[model samples]
Target: MSESFNQEQNPSEEKFTSSFPPKPIVEEKSQNALRRSLISLAIYALMFYFLFDRNIVYIAAILLVLIIHEMGHFLFMKLFNYSNVKIFIIPLLGAFTSGKKQQVSQWQLSLIILAGPLPGIIIGCLLFWLNKDLKNETIEMLYSSFLVINLLNCLPFFPLDGGRLIETLFFKENYIIRLVFGIISIIVLLFLFAYLNPILLIVPVIIGLELYNENKHQKIREYLKHEKINYHVDYVNLPDKDYWLIRDCLIFSFPKKYNLLTPGKYEYAIVEPIVIQQINAVLQVNLNPDLNLFKRVLMVLFYIGIFVGPILLFLLNR
Candidate 1:
């Protein structure tokens, strides 16, 4: 994806920025923040020890690979001028990079998703090649683990790098489609674990928890949609990719728009018409509703290949 943004500013940018009310700021004590950080580090260290059976070398190698993977994501986010870029390590599962994006294109999103895994995959390949001659058990183990971790991270499951790519490429504007895919992904993972490694049921359990959280948030949005109140319309110039995020924020944070001047006693609306109109204009500029059948088929095949290819190779080698 092209990294460059259009230099020309929209004429409405000033008007848009001026219309919205300022967001409230929350203050936090530095000491409190420092204490929380220390606690989190302690927990992470304990988890790392338990996870790797106190193998210092293994822990160091794993952390290195994970940091590289996250750096790939962070770099791209920085390139795109995303705010508050940070990587959080989830003791057992993996690391995730998050940032605040005002707007992003689909291709830009794809680049970010691939960034999280591609660098690690490349480094893993290089390590595997270098260790091919020496055949040192530790180096070989690290090489294999690196490759396997990255490949697995590309699976078509929610909260994974591959799943994020799939969502951007295929489910772009449709919340329902993404939700349904998330559910199906959980089911597929459950069956795969049952057949291959029941001990890995934790994978699906984590995904299930993610889905539950999303559902809970969705319910809150639904409630907000029906609440009776009025809101002044604020125009913001946003890209097509950001429409959904902004819409979701509006759904959860504000009451239904009633009237321009006063709160309508009975009328209810999810958002003001002007807001929808602006969003639609942005959508019209970039929306591609249909993914071709051939590409869709290829994506499905790619998903299957990533999930099954490694297992087949391992068995064949054995």
Candidate 2:
């Protein structure tokens, strides 16, 4: 009887073990992430050394300002519960903070964009106040650099904080508009380089290369549409009014082919269907508050202040 009981118990134990597998190795993933971060740091150090002409003091100062700007973005991303937040240094260009969000609203996007530059602007203002009495050249230079960096960051150009804000707020998924804007940005950069510093022609050249690459990708996507391919459709249960906003947000956050399904007039209930192909993934958009007139007015005023404030302060002090 004891032998029979042991035999039955062993099979049950084996079945239970088979049903529940072990958890994933968290440490391995963490170690891989650490390794990548170290590599990035090494690259940034090398680039900075060459870019700054080995001026440690200047490098330190620029790094401090860049870190502070990126920290603002990082903190806000964390606040919004975004995943995999990381700040990358782009040598001569600038530092950028990136994170993943399943669904983001227009207001949230605007706030995140503003977060990077707003803190720097505030610090610039404080530096201006401090330099008022002392008249220190170092303080003046720091203040000027801080203000210029942050203010220029707010410009509505692609990849810039200001450009991102405009894209989220107005352009949405309109590729044509974006392409036009990109061309305009390149032209403006060329003119600025010609007027300000001819040596800065490298910036426009880089922009042109990037634009060319983007256009090539766009053509590929267009060609894919004409080919016969297996596609998946996802129907999202959302109101008609919320369709475009959610569609824009999804496309902006996660780039993919998306088509909006229109319901018949006889259909009483609205179920927004999104047809997706090439990627097998389902996304649900969360409803978020819309931007109002009051907020719009405030944003405009804030932008005006940041742009003119530094120049005005310098003139007044001089």
Which candidate ranks first by lDDT, i.e. highest?
A: 2
lDDT of 2 by residue, 17-115 (tens): 322222111122545655665566556667778865666665666667788898999999999887678777665566788766656776887788889
Model 2: lDDT equals: 0.60
Best by TM-score: 2
Alpha carbon deviation, residue 118, candidate 2 (Å)? 1.1
**TM-score of each candidate?**
0.61, 0.64
> Superposing all C-alpha atoms, what RMSD in Å does each candidate have to the true structure?
11.3, 15.9
Write one digit per residue (lDDT tens) for candidate 1, span 1-318.
011111222212232233333222223354664465456545666787986576777777777778788889999999878766766766655667776554566656677787877777667766766766787888877877678778878877776788777887877567588789888888888887778656567888887876664554444333323332111112234333233333433333233432231211112244445445433322322434344667666656755665575456456555
For candidate 2, report its TM-score.
Answer: 0.64
Clashes of each: 0, 0
